[model samples]
Target: MPESCRSRELPASLLTNPEMVRACRARDFARVFRLVKVYAGIYPSMIARRCELTPSRVGEVMSGRRQLQHMDVIERIADGLRIPGHMLGLARRTWETPLALATDGRTTPQSVASDPVAPASLPGAEVDSILTLTSRTDPSPSMLQALRSSIEDYWRRDDQHGGEALRPAVLGQLRYVVGLLKENRPAAIRHGLYGVAAELARLTGWTYFDALQYNQARAYFTEALQLSKEIDDRQFMANVLACMSLQATYQEKPADALALVNAAQDEARAAPGTTPRVLSMLSLREAFAHASLGNRYATHASIGEAHRHFDQIQRGDTDPAWVTYFDEPKLIVDTGIAHGRLGEAATAEPLIAEALRRENSTNQRGRAFHAFWLARTQLGLGKLDQACQTATDALEPAASVASERVAGHLREFYDELAPHREEPVATAFESRLRVALPMRVSGSPRP
Candidate 1:
């Protein structure tokens, strides 16, 4: 068969699969390409040169030519585009399943636990729903406000119920909101929506990181940081920096994490009182960075500083628009988790348990994290039964949310129990852990 004709001979299954067709018909291919181009800025031409493809060829594939069916060719394009493997469907066939199942893949009940970056896979149904919503031109002001209000409600509810109970719902809402943002592209909406995009991107990175999808997570984080910067929101930028620091710590680069945290601290200091909540968050980041670096004294100092900032927040403190979500209890819970990471099980246990006790009054997502850390502390102390129970307890909340950071902690806890796989407590814990973790595409191990 002639090469050009051979492309035509390729099975429809290869080029016209539902996803491929959707990508083409919905113009997602072009959008994704454009996003990449915009993200690459001056480097798009440079990237094309290195890939031995003309800039026009790059445009052609992105513009949805029906003949681009070769997997190798798609991969090369993705590489040149700097698209994450998972997003490009190059990681595994996980996207074939529901988002929940994809999220729980290899870590199911029977399999040995593995780390996979488990970002909420954009389900076909969800994508269609988003498309339907976005297809409308000039969405009504009330409708746009309604969408924004709905997103705000998710954040508020997540804060109130704890992140766990509201995670899946929140993720669904976020995906919808992102679609709306893409469709509308209104400057006024973009001002606020940029922060939302950064948050979503951060969450996506965390999920991917937990699923051991480092490259994808990294890409998401990079995008998040850039978005945050574009908005010129210092607090959000600091949060993104803190997130990057956490990623560095998990990747076992404590120095890098510390550096990022320090940079965040500098940013936070420069803009004190501009966003007290984010500033408090930066303090927590400092604590975590110190903990990761094994600087016990510095960790304690940072935690104290965080606590002081928390104390300063009066009933009427003027918080930035983006940071209206945090409060004292949330700060305590976050600090507790950091202490746990530092191996201060004695200090961490009471604080975590307290956080869990009050979690019912706050966000389901935060509660899930508290539960995971409680389990980690228990595991550290060799309280296998308690650890198993706490770990199992964590799932109820975890299953409700879409944060990869929570999953990453669970994976670490699972690894901790692996050495004692013969013990009954460990066995039970392992079983539950598998259900929570599932196998990921990259097969990377947890820190």
Candidate 2:
């Protein structure tokens, strides 16, 4: 073995962290070897020499063939490597258990640690058979259907409960589907899988963004955009770009947001017979970006474009599944908020009121968004009491759901009300607002 590969005294702390144990159990040999190598730089090799085995034994353990038989040998290895007794035991236990591939095709063993159940329904059987077959053959129609059904199940769970309950499962399913798609090289499967991947990435990004993990969200969105491009689905690409723009705007990067919106607009223009809803959505993103940059004229121009696009969209036009929720009234509400941000209270107030009224007949998630933005507009107009009430209303549904955008709007509304707390209207608003909004341990509104 090379001198650099020699083991040395390490810290007990390394073994305690579950991530490290997982790394070892998964046979991440390079990582384990590299960690020991790094430790050698800080400690002398004499401590390692005291152990019966050399650095090569550590390598053997990581490579999964070495059976640790003696307690003294394990102890000396732990002592030399500075791994804690309990953690060393855990590492040994993990090593003994055969590492199983997760359903997602990741090398990590399934955390649930239960026996596999047989497929129950036709769909389940189809998925099982496809997964088994794809281990050898190309993806078939049954495989595509199974994958699509799984994706649909994720959506159904999200719609019925909320993203919080479904996100982890959805992410695992996405990884599994991607693995299957990669393993089987059929064109149809690839195309379907790309669409599914883009959607999953978009959802994952949105979920992480809600959790205030911006970097993680951006990584997912970046992957989503790349997948959208691969499928040549202009509408999906535009939507993904719009989502990226929203993330940028929220992060206070207005210029980057505008750039994304512009790119999306170009993509929409190139798309054949694009639906009005999609065009309006792209325009809405552009308007928001312009408003964030304090470009009132550009914002208004974009708002107008948004309305024009919404007007042109026919009722029965084919739209992407993701965008089907948006309609003419929804487009109007979105444009109205853009106007509100541009300081057009006269034009915004009635539109906001109409949106709130329409929301009563809409989905919970959409209603929450409508309420949030309306509250924002109300705050802008110095209608503190109404703003607070609207904000409280918005938060009611949002608290039960897993949407970052809705929660963010509510937070912004709270921030806008912060400076005027002494005023009677603001005071009244604050009393109720504080109770409705989720707060951190520091008693500050959650971002």
Candidate 3:
């Protein structure tokens, strides 16, 4: 192990610290991460490397954007940070003696339990009474308001931090909303709950898709569709199907993506009061699908229609929350990307740069993505020095963020830069890449 690896022999004082024990028992990973940093004197990147996770993932957990739920992750945290096994709800530390051996030959070790004693089981009648009492208390107006606020917060965070960092917590909220549906509530409340639940499911699906977890994304999209149908909300359902269509576009199923977007348009036509913003987003996806298929004429037509619809969207329009992010800047950047894919780098370069300039600094993931695109465009234009510099600028964000899309773009940039490897600028970029990213080497060609 490297000298930077956390030692298992954490100081005895920290091991027995009351606050550390409490934080662990509460599953407050942020607190635990901080305690480990403060006590173990290790960097977040070192902890991430030791745990075999992305640095942004560690930051996400510490920032409450992701939860440490999986047993494997929990165990890795214990092992990497040298946290006490008992602190992570595990058996006693390996150094501790076994308390018993099962007939199956498994050793059960005793742990110093710091939590208070368990409560006594209720009598059968009391249990029934408690259940009835709980079910009678439907999800409150305040609770629904708070969850909506949380959903909006999730959207904003996802915009800034990217989907990989937000998926776990978003999924947790989805599960909670689903559970809320099972409770007794008024018809109106149930209807409202359906709306929020459907949005959450769609958001979760979008995040999962962004993270490149296709199967999980599909599952959430299916659930979102079902929830939307339950409320008979055609507009909302159209939006979700549009989301699915966008995912299909990225998954390389251009035909399927086109079909889904067409379906979304059909649903929008039937919607009672679908906003122009929603229609514009669906049109944008249609353009994306066409671009994937190399149908330049159709792609241009769809883009034109999208622009028209977007122009119709007035301020104070009652558009869905999800579609609010689809502004002129997004349309321009996406159009540039479409043109770039078709080998129109000359036309793509300025548009992409303009969009990047307007983009907010807090959106690190977005910056990385656009920066990669700009680098690729510069490379296509044979501006090797600029390309190398732009690509190098992308590396810092790529190193710390857990984004499969950004990572994939970086790989493609490396491949594109391969032929130019003998160039000094390319060589310098590779050297920086080797230190900045965990990607495979792109220095020498394979024989």
Per-residue alpha-carbon lDDT of model 3 for 1-447, expressed as tens digits?
A: 554333445677877898987787556788887887798765676667656556766776788765555566776677665676655546444544344442335555444333223224323544544644564436878878888898999877776667665655665566557757875788888988888889888987887787888886888898899999998998888888888888898789999999999999999989987888888888878888998899989988998898899889888789877777777777788878878866779988998889988977677778889899999999999999999999898887766666777777887888888899999999999888887863445443320
Model 2 steric clash total: 0
Ranking by lDDT: 3, 2, 1
Q: Which stretches of candidate 3 lie over 4 Å from their true place?
A: 1-137, 438-447
Cα displacement (angstroms), candidate 1, residue 161, comes to 13
Overall local distance difference test of candidate 2: 0.66
Per-prediction backbone clash count: 31, 0, 0
Lowest summed-lDDT stretch of 10 residues in model 1? 2-11
Better of 2 and 3 by lDDT: 3
Cα lDDT for residue 421, candidate 1: 75
**Candidate 1 segments exceeding 4 Å error:** 1-144, 153-212, 321-325, 361-365, 399-407, 418-447
lDDT of 2 by residue, 1-447 (tens): 643344432445665455667544332434554565564443223323544344444444545534333445555555444454334322233322243442346566534222223233223434544644554546567876776677666665554345655655555555555655655476877888788778887887776675567886787788888888888888777887888898898888999999998998889889887888888888888998998888999998888888888878776888877786676677778778787767787788789778668653425666787787788777777777787777766656765666666666766766777787678876665566556543511255434
- Among all windows of 10 consecutive residues in model 3, the one with the lowest summed lDDT is 113-122
Candidate 1 residue-wise lDDT, 320-414, digit = tens: 65466466566777788788878889888888887677655345566777887888898888788898898888776776655666667777777
Global lDDT of each candidate? 0.63, 0.66, 0.77
The C-alpha TM-scores of every prediction are 0.61, 0.67, 0.70
